[model samples]
Each structure stands twice: as C-alpha cells, then as structure tokens.
Target: MPRNTLIAGGVLVVLGVISYVASAFASVTALIPAFLGVVLVICGLIARKKPMLGVHVALVVALLGLVGTFMNVLKIGEVFAGTAERPLAVVVSAITFVLLLIYIALGVRSFVAARRWKKADAISQA
Candidate 1:
C-alpha cells in the first residue's frame, strides 16, 4: 500500500476496532455507523492508486455510511423513546444505499482491470 493508503487503512482498522468495542455497550452502539464511515474513508483512500472510478465510489460510500449511521441512530431513538422520526435519516439512508450500489460496481470494474493489467504485464515480460 502507498503511504496514504497505509495511513488511512490504519485509521479505519482502529475505528473498526473501536466500533466493535462500542457495540458491547448499549450507549455506544449508536455511533457504530460513524465509525464505519471512518473505516470506509480509510479503505477509499487506500484504494486511490488503483482506479479513479473506484476511488470516487469509495469516497461516496464513506459519505453514505455516515448518513446510514445517522439514520440508524435516529430510527432507534424514535422507536424506543419519545423522539419523533427524522426525515433526514430516511433521506440519508436512501442516498447511502444508492452510493453503496455504485461503489460495488466500481470495485468490480477495478478488480477486472487490475487482473487484465497483470496479465498484460506478465505476457510482455515473457
């Protein structure tokens, strides 16, 4: 991994660890999505050198993950407590889902391209 990717991945790995810990406590479960966002951002940054489209998609997925987490908190608050449902949560969730689909598509495309590149390089060397 490049310097930036290694750095970002390290951060994400940390965040993921924190999130998993937080899940063990009721008070911290709500923050899980935000932590997931941090991880996604790390993944995106790490993959930046691989493909332009994939990078963009990763960034978007990170943003959506943030929104999804926020929505999850809101939904939980509304259902369990007296808090009213926040429309923002719904909006964010929708956007996040769409972005996730795009991210997966880009990831697959990048994987295919990378494979092709390796094959071409190997053939040329031979």
Candidate 2:
C-alpha cells in the first residue's frame, strides 16, 4: 500500500492500455503488455492490505517482463531485416522495453520494503 506501489500500478495500467491500442495497428503479440498490466493492477490493489503478496506478484511480473524484453531485443534485427519496414513496431517495442524496466524497479522496491517490514516485526516481537 505504499504510495510508490500505487503509482507504479497506475502507470502500468495506463501503459497497458496504450499497448493494447498500439497492438491494434502492430501485431497480436502486443497483447502481452495488456495482460501484464492487468496483473499489475490486481496485485497493486491487493498489495494495499497484503504487501508481501503484492511484492511476490510484482517480482514474477518483472521476471516475465525481463524475458519478454530480452526476446524482443534479440528479434529486432529480424523484424527490421525486411524491406517492407514498419516504424510503429519499433516504437512499440521501445516503449515496452522502457515499461518493463519501470516494472522491475517498482517490483524491487516493493520487495525490499516487504523484507524490511518483516525484519522489523521480528525485532519488535523478540
């Protein structure tokens, strides 16, 4: 329920909507971001009461984003190799990559906060 987690979730939801719109013109594969966005929103909402769960969900999403971005980067050459080039595809890909990085940052931050909270609770109880 930290402010940053809420902001991050909101950002992800917006980005997902943008990705869905972009997918209309690009490729069906673009749906990945939309899906991730939904998951992030759900996690964020749940995180308000159960931050540990949210942190775990965010970490999983971040891992997925990392893998997806890596694959996209590797396939960039193949995507542009054809003469019938599509600039929009490249732009979408770049945007996705950036969003993924943001997701990772948010996930890491939430995770660290959750860990600290656990440690503090243990110390207080002890």
Candidate 3:
C-alpha cells in the first residue's frame, strides 16, 4: 500500500507539473495536485514506520482531494460538449478526482486484507 501510495503521488506530481507548464505558469492552481501529492508522498514515507497511522493519513488526504474535485465530474460533460470555459482545468480536476477515488478504493482493500490477516492470525494463536 505504501508503495502504491508513492506511485500515485508521483503520478499526481507529474500531472501538476505538466499542467502548470502547459499553462505557461500562469495558474498557481495548477499546482494543487502537486501539493496534494507531496502530502501523499509524506504519508507513504511515514507508513514505512507506522503503517496504520500513515495509511489513515493518506486516505484522509485522498478523500479530501476527491471531495474538492467532485464538481469537476459535472464539468467533464462540458468538456466533452466543447462548451467548457476551461476545458483543460476541468479535465485535470476530473482526472484528480478519479485518481483519488481509485486510491481510496485501494486503501479500503488494503484495510480489509489487513483485517482478515489479523483475524486469521488471532484464530491460529488461539
């Protein structure tokens, strides 16, 4: 899970850099993904020492990202229709939303697996 988080963070960071560069550095907002990615990366690193807490932190951050970019889901329609005022921004936001959603799902799956593993280990010990 930590490895996956790191990979996701790297992807998000690259996305932010590409978007910012494409905008000619005119929009600071383009770096939002980068900021979020940095936090995720930190969380990933922390997970190496404290898996539970670090995963929780990373999941929370991802949830926030998903909520923040949720509106872009609607804007995606405009993008497809060629009516979006800022199509690229909308696309970027939608991409972020999807990525966060996937990350959250992965986190949940990891939690479930951990729970099962713990339960099994407890049963064996008993």
Candidate 4:
C-alpha cells in the first residue's frame, strides 16, 4: 500500500475519534460523522493489506463523504439558525465539514492508488 493511504487512514481514525468525542456535547445528528469515521478507519486498515479491497472501500467512503458534505452545505442555514443562541454548534459544524472534505480527498487518493496497484499486480501475475 502507498504511504499516503496509510497516512490518510490514520488521519481518518484520529478525526473520527475527535468527531466521536465532540459529538457528545453536540446534537444527535453529529453522530453521523462519528459513525463514518469508524467505518473509514476499518476500511483504511483493510485497504492497507489488500489494494483490491481498498479500491472498493475507499471509493465508497469518498462517495459518502461527498454526499455528506453536500447535504451539510445545503443545511448550513438550518444548522446555524440560532447561531447567537449556540455558537459552539456553528464551530462544530464547520469543523466537521472541513474534516469531511479532507477525508473525501484522502479516500479518493487511496482509491486511485489501490486501482493502480491492483492493475500492476494483475500484469505481474500474467
């Protein structure tokens, strides 16, 4: 596996932990990112050993991250409807949004790398 893939996975796991801990004080909806973080970590670990598996897993994670980020962007207004009442909510939302972007980028990179690795492996075997 590429070093970047491993690094990305590690970063995702750490971010997931952060999200999980941060969610405790935020609304129930915050758990969504927390859950995603765990999934990403598991997939990342698996990908480290099997590029073919990583390709599929990383792609899924990338797609989900994109969708999640898009949905959150659309709902940003609703999230910050009462910014004056709860400033922390805005901060947390922003943090989660940024993390999602980073996660998505890393996932895509890993996915591409995995695909290349798989192709190379096939060529070598033949």
- The 10 consecutive residues of candidate 1 with the worst lDDT sum are 1-10
lDDT scores of the candidates, listed in order? 0.51, 0.65, 0.90, 0.59
Number of the top candidate by TM-score?
Answer: 3
Q: Per-residue lDDT for 1-126 in model 1, tens only?
A: 223333433454455455545446434433443455565666556565554544555556555564555545446545446564643334334434444444555556766888899999999999
TM-score for each prediction? Answer: 0.43, 0.64, 0.97, 0.54
Per-residue lDDT of model 2, residues 1-126, tens digit only: 444555655665676667667667456555655666667777777777887787577667757766766755555666567632554555455566777677677667756887899999999999
Candidate 1, TM-score vs. the true structure? 0.43
**Candidate order, TM-score descending:** 3, 2, 4, 1
RMSD of each: 9.1, 3.9, 0.8, 4.9
1-126, model 4: which lDDT tens digit per residue? 334445545555565556556657456554555555566667667776885686467556756665665644555565557534444444444555676566557656766887799999999999
The candidates, ranked best first by lDDT, are 3, 2, 4, 1
Q: Evaluate model 2: give its TM-score.
A: 0.64
User: What would you estimate as the lDDT of candidate 1?
Assistant: 0.51
lDDT score for residue 109 of model 4:
73
In the predicted model 1, the residue pairs found to clash are none
Stretches of candidate 4 exceeding 4 Å from the true structure: 1-26, 75-94, 106-126
